[model samples]
Target: ERRFSVDLVGEVVRNFTLTLWNTYAFLVSYANLDGWQPAAGGSPAAPAALTDLDRWILSELHTLVGSVTAAFEGYDVTGATRPIERFVYDLSNWYVRRSRRRFWKSGAGPDKQAAYATLHECLLTLSKLLAPSMPFVADAIYRNLAGAQQPESVHLADWPAAEAARIDPALNHDMQIVQRLVSLGHSARQRSKLKVRQPLPEAAFWAGADAAGVIARHGALIADELNVKQVRLLNSDLEAVAYELHALPRELGQKYGSRLPAVRDALAALDAATAARTLLAGQPLALQVDGMALELLPTEVEVRLQARSGFAVAAEGGLVAALVTDLTPELVREGLAREVVRRVQELRKSSGFQISDRIRVRFQASAQIAQAIAEHHDYIAGETLAVALQAGAVSADAWLIDAESLAVQIELAG
Candidate 1:
């Protein structure tokens, strides 16, 4: 007979329960499921007007379906879980997280409907894909999403087929690069002890030719993700920064056994700016040693960037880096406005206000924060679903909020 400890079983049960509850909270609460459902045709159709983010997610979904199918066919349970996990992460973290405002916007328009449809499709597809390994959880999601229209049991549903036409390899590749750059941008902010909610004036990305092109194409996304007003590709600007080059001893030694010392000395002595420019241009660095010219490929030398005095930089594999520390007065004001919005949101949550609830806000702030609120009145109101926002004293029943050492009061409308 197999024996299971009660403590171990209790822990497992608690974890499972929390996981299900969190999943439900995300789908029903965060995603606003009341407004999202499969349409009359059954499966949610791809929206007619799809943004780059939407298209990229759809492409990823197609890729995930193929991976899951292959893994299941090969009887590799662990392999199947990998794609499911990745898809879920991307769906919740990237797609839904970024598209929250679109869904929460007051009116239902084509764009809003499209966001709903895209997310709905992703969730439903994810349900069917996950049904094999997590039948109970999958059934709950599937039933709530599609039980009324489709098969009652998730197990009875057919496996989701990959839509080859929806798969865009180029877009996927570009999005992956963008994701990496955004993650590095966050790392840069964390290193500088800067909060992401604070808006920065600009961020510069130094990437290889291909990655640079993709970054340029998706510059706006990088900016938004990093909470910066502008994203500038640091192609020419790389010369302004300092670079330290280290010759890989093992690789270079194998190529030039006796000349290794000369190569190392030459590499260290090379003009940092010129070497950066040369490597960025995808050209080999030519060195003259012992009356013979030897060419050093870009890969033969590892490059490290020294963050300039006014910049905070985070680099990955020396191929990509982001600089984002400059803050102008205007940018600081905007950052203050963003901070105010966050504080108000926290107050709303604490007051037990529903996501759709509108409130009246009155604030008494420092001159700087008040000025910021005046400048971004409409923006703050829109974001927080405030029916009215003004500078004044708080009413007795109003919720009080403190942001950046400034006092604010908010009252939900009946």
Candidate 2:
């Protein structure tokens, strides 16, 4: 009777680990054969981890154990695997990439401190979740985070206390929408044959599903990341066109059997939101055929809306489509402003400028560029390590310039 909801997670993890290690081990073994020296002897990292990045990884590893323990208590293996996937795929990939500069920062500064703190938290969490699955990697990360004052092995210590307050439903929802928008943006970039680094004029999103204030609150973030000057909310006519649905073949046919056609027709009669809520909430859709009622579960259903005509960005359920809008004068200025700061920073870094190093930039360009920088002088100063920016390009030998980039050369003129 106790086996009613048995925990197979430990075995599941073991099986998954074996599959993964088999793939990894083959590569490493073959590498050793090809390299003339054993691949296992390779030192891809330092002999001992001492950097902030190392500490960050350790902290995330430890924190992850607490999460896994909580997930196990709830008997939710799927929830448990989520953070594990994050550690491997997202925390490892995105966090590591974002913080590389801090890890490789030649000099210690505020930037370095921030990078360490962020990475440490991620590492500690990841290590804790991993402890039960791969004790060695878990212990290694845990011990490193512990350092002189903390316990040697996290396993020998007490189970971590839960921090339930840290979970915010609103933030999670916002992040999910943001992630979908980002995916759509990446798709748009690919379709345009443009790299993310290339500046985009504007992006428009059709958000018929967005709650009243959520889109407004996070609109700035969407605009910034997409390099668009503005985000336009499409009209209701566009929303209807974008939200048209199509039936999923296998999903409906298998679950409903003969009841599928009636259910599909009933769903088509309902609007996107009403149909989604009714089907998702475990409420019976009440499709009657031969006077017999049927029930539909969430997973047994799949509904996706089609792309609307002239829509720059739209999402029906999880599927997304985006459209490009005309870039505003304001957007072009912001893009230019970003470019100016980037070039300035490159100049500062290469010139061995201190974080507080104040410099002057005098660029002669169309009145458009001049007015743009002038309007956002404080931002320009903060971002570019500039004491003052004067709009006039003069011949100077010391300045490093790139005119082809529509950017005049810059330097520390004595």
Candidate 3:
């Protein structure tokens, strides 16, 4: 019953993501099959045994779907729209980017395959949920993944039956804490104006018991996303979280004269959380400095944080850092492989390589990269469409440059 033009819808489509919208339509590549889907279909199916992580994701999805659908029924398309988009854009993008390879090479392995297949199924389920809001984007993803293989269009797929039985509440809460922990790091980067691509040596946080498990399970995810080498959990109480308080010693000293310490102490005595919120909200405070009435505005001071134990601690903007642990050689190499694929994909995008275009690539690089390529040779070949790669040879028809700290070239081979 809602009315808008194709142009308007097209414009809205541009604002949404393909994977996000695909979650709206149901099954991929299928047309007009809305009541049932490839996995659970419309009625209901018992979930195949899934990973705790996977089950947790499904639990989150179901939570969102019930709420989103209710919003839709109430004519709050915007409300329905936002959650699905966020889950796909945030959770799916973050997780899939971190775990794709385990699925890629699983072949017939049941557990790993289940891990991947569950995610894949989740993606489809989400696309159906989103299609009511964004048609074009949902259709494209649906067509690509399941369309040719099974379904005709994602839009026609039915909504999956809602089930809350499989969700892990503890995992969900822990994840939210971890998410907040990651956000604190990202906010720090924002304050520093640091681009995510730049790597950092380490980040340490007062990893409390509440967020510890979440951080442990996805510590690698945090490192990869934040470009930090190491994450640490420290039990310390004295590390200062930084922020501009309403009264810095020198600034307040000039105003308060002999009373500066008392004023500073009073301000410091306020909990970090309250001080930050008050500062952010532009709330005004009244104080007497040298027996003169003073009014304080929020922006006059700044804040930052360092880890502490039993300090009941936090950073300005309420950011709490999460620690990272464990890095394996295999993990590093796999990350490099993804970087190589990214370079290839970027070139393809720039040079107008068609979706199905076959290509050849040659790489010239240091021994380390050469070995990485040699080790993941099949993966590299499949990823880059490269017919051959050698340590010394250069491609005659290829784009050549550097990637993963290695010189490389790629082209359509004759």
On TM-score, the leading prediction is 1
lDDT of each: 0.77, 0.55, 0.59
My TM-score estimates for the predictions, one after another, are 0.81, 0.49, 0.61
Please give the TM-score that candidate 1 achieves against the real structure: 0.81
What lDDT does candidate 1 reach at residue 317? Answer: 45
lDDT, candidate 2, residue 292?
70
For model 3, the local distance difference test gives 0.59
Query: Where is model 1 more than 4 Å wrong at Cα?
Result: 1-24, 30-36, 245-267, 270-304, 394-404
Worst 10 residues of 3 by lDDT: 27-36
lDDT of 3 by residue, 1-414 (tens): 657888767755565554454433322222222122334332222356465556667778777778788888899978987777567765545455555454444244545545545666666666677677667766776665563445688766666556767556777786677667777777666655544544565565655565666667777766766778866665542343433355665655676678767776666666654565556445755555446666655544555444333222344332355333233565456556655677767777777875446777666665556676778888777766666765666543333323335655657767
Q: State residue 94's C-alpha deviation in candidate 3, in Å.
A: 2.5
Q: Which tens-of-lDDT digit does each residue in 225-344 have in candidate 1?
A: 889888877755453256788888888988999899998888777887678667755679999887789899887887767777777777664454556677777777788888889888
Pick out the ten consecutive residues of candidate 1 with the lowest summed lDDT.
395-404
Which digits, one per residue and each the tens of the lDDT, describe model 2 over residues 123-193? 45456666676788678766755445456686874555545443444555555566577667777666555
By TM-score, the candidates rank as 1, 3, 2
After superposition of all CA atoms, the RMSD between model 2 and the true structure is 12.6
